[model samples]
Target: MQPYKKLFTYWFAVIIYDLTVDFTKSYIKSFKLKEQMDGAARSGKQNIVEGSEGMQTSLKSAIKLTGVAKASFEELIGDLEDYLRQNNLKQFPKNNPKIEIFRQKAAVLIKKLSDFYKNESLVRNLSNLSYLEKYFNTSSVEEKVNLLLTLCHQETFLLNKQVLSLEEKHKTEGGLTEKLYKARVQHRGY
Candidate 1:
C-alpha cells in the first residue's frame, strides 16, 4: 500500500518514536530508559506494518498484532506518566487549557504527516515528528511529558478502532481456513 494506506497507527508511532528520542536526548539522561522508550516506539510502529501485511493471509494474526501495537503505546504512556510523577511535576487534567493547545498541535502534526510521503528529504519528513519539540524548548519537562501523554492517548484510542474494524471484518468475511474450507467444498461439489 502507498504510504501505509491503513489507519494512522504506524504514522502516529513514528511521531512517538521521534518525540521519545527528542525527549531522551534533551531531558532524560538514563541510557536504560532511552532503550525502553525506543524499543516501544519501534514495536508500536513495526507491529502495525506487520499486521497489515499479514491481513491477506490471516485476519486473526493481524488483530493480534494490532493489539500488540496498542500494548506498546500503553507501555509508553505508563513510562511517560511515571517520569512526570517521579520528577515532582504535575500532570494536567483533560480539561486543562494547556492540554487543548497540545491537542491542537497534534492535529496539525497529523496533517503534516499526510504530506510526508511526498517529501523528498527523509530528514525533513522525520523533522515533522518534532513539531512538539518547540514546546519542549521553553516548557518544563513535566509539561512536555504531559503533551506526549495526550498524543499517546489519542493514538491508542484510534488503535482500538482499528482493532474493532478488523474483528468485524473477520466476523463477516472469515479467514484463511474458511476460504480453504469453502474452496474444498466447491471442488467436491458439496
Candidate 2:
C-alpha cells in the first residue's frame, strides 16, 4: 500500500478507539478531559493526512512531520491510560479488548512498514536525516520517505491537539484567575 495511505489507516484507528471510549462513558464528569481525548484523536488522523500531502513535494520534510505524528499518538496513549486510572475506570481490558481490533491493525501496518524499510540502501541515505533514519533500516527512497512522513504527521497532530484542548480547558476553569487576582492586588498595592 502507499505509505501515506497506511499511515492514514493507523491514525483513523486511533480516532475510532477514542470515539468508542467517549461514547461508552456513563458519566460526563470531566468535559475537559473528554475534549482533550477527542482532540488528540482528531490530531492523529489529521497529521497523517497533512504529512501525506506534504510528501508529494518534500520527502525529507514529510518524514520529519510524520515523526511528530507518531510521537503524538504515543503521548495520547499514555494520557488515555492515565486518565482511565485516575478516574477509577476499570483496567483497560486485556490487550484493550475494546480497541484491540483497531490497535492490532495499526500495529501490523506499522510493523510491516518498519520491516520493509530495514533495507541497506535506504538506511545509508536516511543516515543523513538522522531524526528520520531511526524509523527505518533501508529501503527504496519512496518507501522510506513515505513511511516517515506518515508516522510524523499522525503522532504530532494527536499531541498538539490534546495539549491545546487541555490548555483551553484550564483557561476556562479559572486556572488564570490567580494570575489575574495577583495583578489586581499589585495594582492596588501600588
Candidate 3:
C-alpha cells in the first residue's frame, strides 16, 4: 500500500493547519475557541495520516479514520462559518470569481507539493505553506474565513471519495487478514 504521506490531501491538511494557526492567532481573541479550532484542524490532518498508515493491515480501520478526518474538517467548516456570521462578514458565494481563482491556485500548489514529495531526493526540502501564508497574511478576516471554509469543504469531499473507494476495494478483495489466511492455506497445500 502506498503511504498516506504521499497523498495530496495529507499536504492539504498541513496547509489547512498552518492557516488555521495563523487565523486564530491573529484574529481570534477567545482562548477557548482558538484551542478548539486548532484542535479540530490538527485532528483533521492527523487522522488522514493515521488512516493511510493503517491501510496495509486494515482497510476497515483506514475507512473509519478517514471518516473521522472528514468529520473534523466539517467541524472546522462550522467554526469558519460561525466566525463569519458572528462578525457580520459575507462568505464568498459558490459562483464567485475569487472562489474559482483560489481553488485553481490551491490545486496547483497541491500538485506541486505532491510532485516534490514524489521526488524528494531530487528536490530540495521545501514547504508549500509559504504560498498560502502570503495570501492568508494579507487577506481580510472575511476572506480568510471563506478560504478556510472552501478548503474544509474540499478536504471532506476528498475524504468521502477515499472512503467509498476503500470500501469498494475491501468488499471485492478483503483485507490483510484474509490475504494472510489464504497464503497460509496455500503454503500448507490445502
Candidate 4:
C-alpha cells in the first residue's frame, strides 16, 4: 500500500470532509444534506483501506473494492460539479493562479500529515507560506469544492492505474483458489 496511493485518497477525503462540514453549516444552514457527501467520502476511504488490508488474502476482492472507492469519489465529484453548475459557480481552470496556491497548500498539508504517520514521501513540498486552515474561512465554498474536484481527478488517475495492475496480475497469476490448489498438489508430491 503506497502511502501516496490509497493513503492520499483517505487524506483527501478527510480534507474535503473538513471543508464541506464547515461550508455547508453556513451555506445550507443545516447538516442534513451533508450525509450524502459524508457517505461518498467515507466509502472512498473505507473501501480503499479495506481493499488494501484484504489484498494478501483476496486480490480480486481488493480490486473490486478499489473500483468501488473510485466510483464513490467520482460520485462525490460529480455532485459537487453539479452543485456549482446549479448555483452558477464557475469551476476554476487548471492553470488558475489560485489553483497553484491551493495545490501548494495541499502538498504541504499532505506532507505534514504523512510525516505524522512517518510517510514523508506521500507528498512533495513546494511552498511554506501557509496551510489551508488559515484560508478556509476566507475562501468561498465554490473555491473549496473546485479545488477538491482537482484532487478527485488525481485519485481517479491512480485508481485506473491500480485497477489495470490488478487486472494484469489476476490474468497472469490467477487467484487464491488456484494458488491453494497448486500448494495442495505440491504438498502431495503430485
Candidate 5:
C-alpha cells in the first residue's frame, strides 16, 4: 500500500488545494494572494506524497520532506489568517462549539478516506472534496474561513506527530547508508 494514500494529512492537503482554488476564485480579488494560497496548498500535498514515496529509501529524506509539507501548510494557514484579519471576520476560538463540531466531522472524514484506500484501488482525485463543500455550503464565507483554519490546525498537528514518529523510527533503525554498510559487511563475510 502507498503509505501516503492512507494518510489523513495527505488527503486533507488535496482537499485544501481544491477548496482553496475555488474559494479564491469567488472571494479573493488579489492575484498574488490567490496564487500564494493555491501554491502553498499544492506544495503541502506534493511534499507529503514525495516524502511517503521516499520513505523506503531514506528515512531522513522522508523526515525532511514531511517538514516541508508542514511548513507549507503553515504558510497556507497564515494566508487564511490574513484573509480573515483583513476582512474583519471573526475566527472561531479553539473552545468554540462550532470548532468542536468541525473537528468531529473532520475525524469522520479522515476515517472514511482511510477505509476507502484500504478497500479500493483508486488514483488520487477530488472525489471527496464535495463532502467538505457540502458540510459548509450554507455557511457564510467567514464561517468557511474558520472551518479551513480549523482544518489547517488539525493538519499541522498531524504533520508534527508524523514527523516525531519518523524521527523515532530513524533513531532506532538508522537510515539507508547504515543499512547499506551493514549489508555490504555481511555480504563480504565480515
Candidate 6:
C-alpha cells in the first residue's frame, strides 16, 4: 500500500476504535464520566480524519494534527482507567478489563503511527524553517523577530494542549480507586 494510504488506514482504525468505545461506554452510569470519555474518543478520530483530509495541501500540519489525535487517545485511555479504579471497579471483569483491552489496542495503533512518522520526510526541517525565514524577505530585525515569535507561539500552543490533556488524565485518575471502593462498599451495606 502507498504511504498516504497507510496513514489513512491508521486514522481509520482509530475512528473505528473510538466508535466502539463510545458505544460500550453508554452502559456506564456517570454522565459526566461518559461525556468526558466520549469527547476524548471523538477528538482522536476527528483529528485524524481532519488531518488526513488536509495532507495534500499541508503535510506538516496534517502530521501535527495526527499527533494531536494520538495524544487525545492517550488521554482518554488514562481517564477511563482512572474512572474504573476510582469506583473500585478496577478488577471487575465487566468494566475495567474490557477498557484495558481497548486501551491496549489504541496504544498499538498509536505506536504504529509514531513509528511510521519517525523519519524526517514527514517533519519540518531547519532548511524548511530557513526557507520560511527567507520567503518572508523581511529586512527589519523587528519584523523577523515577530515572525519567528508567532511561529513559536503556534508550536507552543499545540504542545501545551497535549500536555494539559495528559495532566487532566492524571488528575482524574488519582483518588478514583478510593471513591469507587467507598461507593461499592456503601452499596453493599458494609
Query: How would the candidate models be sorted by TM-score, starting from the highest?
Result: 5, 3, 1, 4, 2, 6
Model 5: runs farther than 4 Å from truth? 118-130
lDDT (tens digit, per residue) of candidate 6 on 1-190 = 3344344334333433444253335445777766776776667667666765655455455656767876665665566455446655423232444334443443454355556645545333222434333444434433332322232223234445544553554356534455678889999999
Question: Which sections of candidate 1 miss by over 4 Å?
Answer: 3-6, 121-123, 128-132, 135-138
User: What tens digits encode model 4's per-residue C-alpha lDDT throughout 40-137?
Assistant: 76788778878877778998998999899899889878877877897899999889887777776666665566556455532222121123446432
Top candidate on lDDT is 5
| Angstrom error at residue 8, model 5 | 1.6
Stretches of model 3 off by over 4 angstroms after superposition: 118-131, 135-138
lDDT of each: 0.80, 0.47, 0.82, 0.70, 0.85, 0.48
Per-residue alpha-carbon lDDT of candidate 1 for residues 35-150, written as tens digits (9 for 90 to 100): 89878877988888889888878999999999999999999999998898888888899998888888777676566665564555643656664534664342667777887798
Model 3 poorest ten-residue lDDT run: 121-130
Q: Native-vs-model 5 lDDT?
A: 0.85
Better-scoring candidate (TM-score), 2 or 6: 2
TM-score of each: 0.87, 0.42, 0.89, 0.78, 0.92, 0.40
Candidate 6: C-alpha RMSD after superposition: 23.6
Model 3 TM-score on a 0 to 1 scale: 0.89
The alpha-carbon root-mean-square deviation between model 3 and the true structure, to one decimal in Å, is 2.8
Clashes, model 6: 6
lDDT of 3 by residue, 1-190 (tens): 3576568788779878888998898899999999999999999999999999888689999999999999999998998998998989998998887777667777876777666666763223234445565644436677778888877888888888999999999999999889999999999999
lDDT of 5 by residue, 1-190 (tens): 6888888888778767778887898899999889999999899999999999999899999999999999999998999999999999988899988888888887876777766865442224445555567765526888788888888899999999999999999999999999999999999999
**lDDT score of model 4?**
0.70
Residue 17 alpha-carbon offset, candidate 3, angstroms: 0.4
List ranges where model 2 is wrong by over 4 Å: 1-3, 6-21, 24-28, 90-190
Q: Taking the tens digit of each residue's C-alpha lDDT, what string does model 2 give over 57-171?
A: 5444445555565565665566545545565554333343433443444455445544554454743443344423332332433333233233333445544564455445445
